[model samples]
Target: MTNRTMTRRDFGSKVITVSAAAAAASLAAPAVLGAAKARVVVIGGGAGGGTVARYVAKGSDDIAVTLINDSPTYSTCFFSNLYLGGFRSFESISHSYDTLAADYGIEVVIDRAAGLDGNGRTVTLANGDTLNYDKAVVAPGIDFKFDAIEGYGPDAVETMPHAWQAGAQAKNLKRQLLDMEDGGTFVICPPPNPFRCPPGPYERISMVAHYFKSYKPHSKIVVLDAKNKFSKQKLFEDGWARHFPDMIEWLPLDITGGVKAVDVASNTIITDDEKFQASVANVVPPQKAGQIAQDAGLADESGWCPIVPETLASLQVPNVHLVGDAIIPGDMPKSGFSANSQAKVCAQAILAELASKQAFKPRFRNTCWSLITTDDSIKVGANYEATEEKIAKIEGFVSQADESDEVRAQTAAEARAWYDAITADIFG
Candidate 1:
């Protein structure tokens, strides 16, 4: 958790390709056209939108770019778990968009994007102002399916925090954990497959266990998962067994019965077979693309937006692109790294289309790191290329189960370095 261990050497090659700034500069410029440059508008100023706006605007002064976000600052979901584990403070993960406006000359609008008029090629904000654009990029993250769970909704978040979107929910979850008494039971109800950050729930459990192990040794943690297996299942299971054997228990779907409901008043989760009592509950419900995507007609029946892999343009709406947690990215997990990588490809394609440049093959990469314990970390990543069919995975790497302590420590350091680099790349 110390900055001294996070060094340039620890990251080496992995951090080099994560940023979009250089990639934007490397794009081939179009032949001198006397025509007025295209106006591009980006919605939701998080990882995807921020990177796209920065890259496209910084790539060329001719193009007029406007970035619309509901808030002036962004809190990353990628490293929020580290905050719970006492590795980082909330302020450390929060970022502002001031540099994007000042350095890149991109107009930053702090307003909620209420509607998208694809037919008219305009984005309407909640304040009654409209932005007309030649091209649009929508990267609004996921929205919870409150109806998926019987007793948990937006109101229930006050008691049982999902902490999936970061910010206040994350702080609330941390407060709940700190309030629990010694020997109290903590329950984590993870969502099903295809959710954001497949390994996130397990990582949260690891962090909670780490916190309890240091202070309340008798505290117990239970994972009530909707799926039978999870990402990096063996690595997580191995780490749990090695570090906190009797303190953590994992109940898969079949074993615990599917989650039927929750009784928030009693701090209990109800399954088909039995009920789980908890001093605190972390219920991660099913999710879908943010409502704006659905309203814009970019999302399909699956409740996720589909995109042309090479250009990242929306399949249903022309000149509209979708990225981040809202898009159905084949062979890619919904992580901040994936979103930033996708934004680069998306930005390049947008600039090329606007400038009438030749098309090039698109390549993408993503690496997700999870801290199993204080100094023990694991990672899973892959390199992908766009094909006629889908974003096919070309190669992959993951932390081994029986790796040396030195390797694990290095991986943890690499994760911290990545967080620092990626946040700088996206925000600055």
Candidate 2:
């Protein structure tokens, strides 16, 4: 097996000979191994769905996994702020599903899920196809609450792109940012509690301010935050003072009364106490679990679906697991990293259930990175433990507020490395 002992021709001949032998064995043993594998239907092909599909398919020879999604490609919401700030391209964040299907032997269906028949244990696609499964995993992410803000709805997203989901909206927001003149104001309205990525809006402001500091030096970014305090507040504020100075300003809920209305035509956003006009406005509205989850009766009055922590199975039903932003795992922030980690736990729990073994205790981890400037970055991360009722925080975690310059820089590097590694784990 020494590398110097084999020539290219000999290697090629040996590969062909091995392939022929395997083919002959498969053909001869047809009756012994021709049974169809057990089917696992996964809905939504974002971080959670893709990871579970790949892991389950690769983990077992008796399981066949099918992933259903609305789009062929997915764009990362995590790094999209960089694109909006003109630091990265769309292709850098976009990923395809081909690798999951081809390399892992998972069947990826590019179609929307119209509904779920929980009782029948089947998922109905938009095209009227029904897929039955022994177990189903749903990770449909977040859905916007159009009526949460007066005079704001789906139609308004065209001009005031939330840019939260990262796709066309992200591109549109970037265009608006570029179209603005120097010294112009950019207004960003962050949603209330329990939204996807708690620190996302602050990070966005930091990144956008980074852009303004370099190009439109006189420009200002005003954050109309609905919450009194946000994730990584002290770190973000320190970063702003050290980096952007007066370029970025934040108005808490009490000061701004929260963004109540937007006059799209005049490019003005009205809060309860004041009215502000801007060259560009980014309004991230209140959110709920994706529509599919709501339609399946998985969501409660609070707009989030509750699940049993250890199994991630819906509290309302059995055998249906909910992961990612869709599930209300207590104390867990809704982020892609959270989703990916939870999906693995769900997969292991499902395998245990199938084998009639005690389900493994679930542990989770999440790390979120924000680019403060071209050079500096901030991050918050934690580990979680699951009980019968809720997912609680465990030890071995760090926050940006606790980091020194060297630690922050090291974390920034880890952030980029993590992005590459996780995307590879999802798509590759």
Best by lDDT: 1
lDDT of candidate 2 over 253-285, digit per residue (tens)? 999889999989888899987899989999999
Q: What would the per-residue lDDT of candidate 1 be over residues 154-203, giving only the tens digit for each residue?
A: 89998999999988999999999999999999999999867899889999
Off by over 4 Å in 2: 1-35, 355-359, 399-404
Please report how far candidate 1 places residue 400 from its true position, in Å: 0.5
Best by TM-score: 1
What does the lDDT read for residue 263 in candidate 2? Answer: 89
The reply for model 1, stretches above 4 Å from the true place, is 1-35, 357-359
TM-scores, all models, native as reference? 0.91, 0.89
RMSD per model, one decimal = 9.1, 9.5
